[model samples]
Target chain A: MAWYFSGDKAVYLQIMEEIQLRIISGFYPLGTRIPSVRDLAEEARVNPNTMQKALTELERSELVVSQRTAGKFVTCDEKRVTEIRERMSSECMEEFLSRMKKLGFTEKEASEKIGQHCAKNETDPRN
Target chain B: MNEILVCSDLCKNYGQKTALSHLELTLERGKIIGLLGPNGSGKTTLIKLIAGLLVPTYGSLTVGGNRIGVETKKIVSYLPERTYIPEWMKVKDILDFFEDFYSDFSRDRAVEMLTSLNIAVGDKIKTMSKGTKEKVQLILVMSREAELYLLDEPIAGVDPAARDYILRTIITNYNENASIIISTHLITDIEPVLDDVVMIQNGTLRIHASVDEIREKNQMSVDALFREVFRC
Candidate 1:
C-alpha cells in the first residue's frame, strides 16, 4: 500500500518508525492491542517475516510487548512515549542547527534568524 | 522451511549463443524477487527453465526440492509474457480448465476477482480487450496458490490503474510459504513490491541483493541503479 515506505530506507526500519510514530501519536493508544503480524504485513504490503522482524525491534525498544496467547500491545508507559517524542525533537533541532551552520550562520545568528523568521510568517510550514 | 528454488552452475546455450551462463543462486520462501534486465539478458530463458519449458545445457536446477519436471511444474505457476490461452474460450471456461488442471486452483477466488474487476464470467476471451485478457490470465495464475509464482511481464502494456490492481492482487493472494518472482523491464512500477532484485547482463549474473540493502548501499532506488548500470 506504500503507506510505510518511501522507497529509500529499509522497509523494516520504516515499519519500526511508523509503529513508533503510531504509539507517540496515540493512533495506537497506551496499552491497546496492536495489529497482528499478518495484518500489519498486509497493510504495509510487506512480507510477514519482515513485519515480525520490525515487531521484534519494537519489542526490544520496550515500545511494545508481546503476551502469551494474547497479541502485542503498546506499552502503557506514557513517560517512555514522551521520551521518544523529545528525542525526535532534539534530533530535528540538531538538523536545523547544522543546516543553518552550513549556510554560514553562527549559533546565535541561527537562533535570532529562527526567531525573526517565526515572527514574520503566520504559519510557517518549515517552522 | 526448504528453499523454494536452487540453481548451481546453470547454463543454457542455443547452438553457441549462450542464453544463461554460470547462474548459481538460491531463493527462499516468502520473498518477492524482481528479475530485471534489458531485452536480451536471459530473463526469459531463466524463467522458462524454471517453468520446465526448456532444459539447461550443462547444469542443474531444482524447484521446491524437486528437479524441473512434472512435480516442479505442478507447484510452480507460470504466467508467460504472451497470451497462451485459446482465444475462443470464455473466461469461465478458462477458470474451469485451470481448476481441472491444477489441484491448487481456487474457483471461488477466480470468480471473485472477475466479479470485482467487472469482468463477466460468460464473456469470450477474444471479445474482451487486451487489458481484460491480461487481467483474466493474471487472475487465473494467482488463484492457484502455488508454491512459486513466475510472472513474466505481468504488468506490461497496461494502464496505471490496472498495474496497481495487479500488484495489489499479488500482495494479497500470495501466502507466506510461497515465493514469487516477477520478471519485468518496468522496474519503477514493481520496485516497491520487490524483496530481492536479480539483475543480469550479457547472459551473466551482475547483481543479486535485497532491496533494502541496495537502497542503503547505493543511496538510490533500484530503477535508478538499473539505469546507471545499463547505461549506453
Candidate 2:
C-alpha cells in the first residue's frame, strides 16, 4: 500500500488518515501486524514521536491494538473495522455530495456520475 | 500552588546590548501562555531564564515558591527550538535516557505510540529525517507529566500538516494542573489554544493578558495585533 502525507493539517492526523485509508482499502487486512513506530517514522520521514501521536489517536479509536512485547497490530474485529469504514465513507460521501450540490449539481446527476466512474474503473484493464 | 511562575525585574544582557530589561510577571497554574515577540526580542532569553538553562543578570525567577535551580528543573519539561537529541542514538535509547533522567516520563506510553506510528525501537536517529527528529523531540517533551512545559517554537520548522499534530498533542497530552508557556511567532496558528499571552518588544514586556481580554479589547486576532505591535 502507498503512504500519503497531507498539507495544511497535523502530521499525526495525516498519519492516522493514511492508516485509516489502508484499513479501508484492505491493504492492512484485519489482524495484520503494522510496522513499528520507528519504521513508520523512517518511511514517512517524520519524528517517531509524531508517529506515536498518530498511533495513539488510532488506538484511542480502537482501530489498532497494542501488546507490550509483541508490538502493535491492526484490530482483528472485522465488524468494528467495517463499522468504522462505513461511517467514514458515509461522512465523506455526504460531504462530497453537499459540495457538489453547492456547485450546482443535482443529487441525481451526482449519483449518475459517481456510478459511471465506478463502473468504468471496474471494467478498466488497470483494475 | 497559588503561583505557577513568579519573575521579578528579570534582566539579561549580552555585553552592551540588553536582552531583557527589568521584566516582572506572574504566571498562574492551569493556563496555556503564549510568549510572543519578534526576532531577537528576548523571547528565547526569557524562557531560558525561566527554564533555568540561562541565569539572569538581575532579579529572580521562581516556580512553586522556589528559586530557579535543580529543584525547579525537575518540574519543567522544555522543548528547545533546535535539536537536542544526539543523531546517533536509537529511538529506544532516547526513551531509555528520558526514563533514566525524568521520573515523570512514561516509557510505556511512548513505546505504544511508536508502535502505532510504525516506528521501530531499534532504528537509529541518524537515519530519520529532520521533520521526524522534531516530532521525536516533541514527543519526549510531551510524554513527561511535569508541572511546567516550556515549548520553544514547537511548530516552527515543520510543514503545515505536521503543525496541527504538534498542536493537538500539546492540547491532548498536557497536564491539567500544569502551566505551558509556548514561545512562537506563528501567532495565528496557536491563537486558538492560548489562554494567556505575554508579548515582548526590545527586551521589555509589551502585552500580558488573557486571550479573551486581548480579543475583546482589540477586536482582532493575536496574530493581527502582533503584526500591528511589532510592525517593521
**Candidate number with greatest TM-score:** 1
Per-residue CA lDDT of model 1 for B88-191, tens digit only, reads 89987898899889999999999999999999999998888888888888999999979999999999999998888887788778687899999999987777
**What does candidate 1's lDDT look like per residue over A1-127, in tens digits?**
5563665677788888888888988999999999988778667766666678889998998899999789999998889889988987888899999999999999999999999887879576665
| Cα displacement (Å) at residue A84, model 1 | 1.4
Question: Best by DockQ, which number?
Answer: 1
Compared with the true structure, model 1 gives a TM-score of 0.90
**TM-score against native, each model:** 0.90, 0.65
Give me the displacement of residue B37 in model 1, in angstroms. Answer: 1.4
Interface RMSD of 1: 2.1
Task: Indicate the residue-level lDDT of A114 in model 2.
Answer: 92
Q: What is the DockQ of each candidate?
A: 0.45, 0.03
- lDDT tens digits, residues A51-121, model 2? 67789999999999999989999999888888888998898999989998998999999999899999999
The candidate that wins on lDDT is: 1
